[model samples]
Target: MAFNGKYELESQENFEQLMKALGLSDEVIKKYKDLGNIVEFVQNGNSFQTSYNYGSKVITNEFTIGQESEFVLFTGHRVKAFAKLEGENKLVITMEGMMAAMELSGDKMIETLTNGEITVKKIRKKI
Candidate 1:
């Protein structure tokens, strides 16, 4: 989704801050530190993922930041809707009320998503 220039920059900063707060590895932070172009973020249920290209290097990863984790930290937050991938797998979880839950902090939500319980697929970031 196309966003206003200001909104896009602010969102990028917000996402980057949230990632750092979650203690994402140095490698991940490095890839997104200067994100000035449009990037794609995909979501399924409570999980989310994204991919991007840094010059000639292509990077992609997926993590499940559940709604009850860090998602709630940013109230009134809405992800820009993008195209849905075909033939993607869905995750099955046994947590009670998982669907109805919302994350209280973006950092915690990111941590939960990276718990290795969810399968992540990488796609090329459209530069």
Candidate 2:
């Protein structure tokens, strides 16, 4: 699978703004703003296990494509989400009021998370 690998955060845009829009406190944002993230994905057919490591915090979610499952967000909020594959290289997850789309391109994984008009984009290089 194209997504089965560990990726290190290369850069991010609007991270603090998006986190604030997501209701994160200034203290919490300051604690994690400069910390890099490592995301690992394990794919097996239609099922996938994804883990996002943010130094002191790690959030993991396991789900099958096109199925509704509970997922823990970076804010430590649990929500029901549905994930689906868009084409061959893009995976999109839809939550209650947010959407996350991750696309694999060569050795890079580009993730975009949108909640209303606020969006955060992170680029990760496979490591």
Candidate 3:
């Protein structure tokens, strides 16, 4: 899927909507926004791994394309999600209540997330 890259967060837009959709409190959202976030994506054929860093804490999840897998999210919750490739540069992940689409172009990775009507966009640059 050509989704392999290590990226640093450049900006986040409408992230409050994402937090609300995830059922997180305002305090928790504030704490999360205060941390430095970094992301890494690895693709080994059909196997995919995505890792996130927040200061001293790190969360990693792995899945296979078109296959159902159970993984841990950044909020420390266990959930079942399916990962699938959309064309050459986009990967879509769908869970129980939310969906995420990640597209890469050049040295930038753009992630768009949605839960119901709420949508958030996060942009990252290669590091």
Candidate 4:
């Protein structure tokens, strides 16, 4: 799959606001605000395993397409999310009041997370 790769954060938008909305503390946000995160993905047919490596912390989740599974958010909040494929290289996950879309093109993956009116966009390059 196009999403099966290790990626490093290149840039992000409205990260601080999203962190605050997710109930993260100012100290925690400050600690990660300027740091780049590494994300890795492994896929096999309809099953996927994704790992978000944030320096000292790493959150990993395994789920199948079109199924509800437990997903751990960046804030350490766990929720039941459903994963669906929009196109060949795009995956959309919906949970609670938030939606995350991950689209892969060339060597970059653009991930957008939306909670109500607040949206955070993270662009990562395959490494």
Best by lDDT: 2
**In angstroms, how far off is 105's CA in candidate 4?**
1.1
| Weakest 10 consecutive residues of candidate 2 by summed lDDT | 30-39
The models' CA-based lDDT, in order, is: 0.33, 0.90, 0.85, 0.89
Off by over 4 Å in 3: 34-36
Please, what are the lDDT tens digits per residue for candidate 3 over residues 1-127?
4778788889888887788777899997887884546888889998988888877888889899999999787678899999988888989999988898989888898999889888888888988
Per residue, candidate 2 scores C-alpha lDDT tens digits across 1-127 of: 3689999999999989988987889998998876658889999988999998778778889999999999987777799999999998999999989999999999999999999999999999999
TM-score for all models, in order of appearance: 0.27, 0.93, 0.93, 0.92
CA lDDT, candidate 4, residue 66:
89
lDDT of 4: 0.89
Decoy 2 TM-score against native: 0.93
Q: What are the per-residue Cα lDDT tens digits for candidate 4 across 1-127? A: 4578898999999989988997889998998886647889898888999998777788899999989999987667899999998878999999998899999989999999999899999999999
RMSD of each: 13.7, 1.3, 1.4, 1.4
- Candidate 3, residue 80: the lDDT equals 95
In candidate 2, how many Å is residue 35 off? Answer: 3.6
Distance from true location, Cα of 32 in model 2, Å: 2.5
Candidate 2: regions farther than 4 A off: none
Candidate 1 overall lDDT versus native = 0.33
Who wins the TM-score comparison? 2
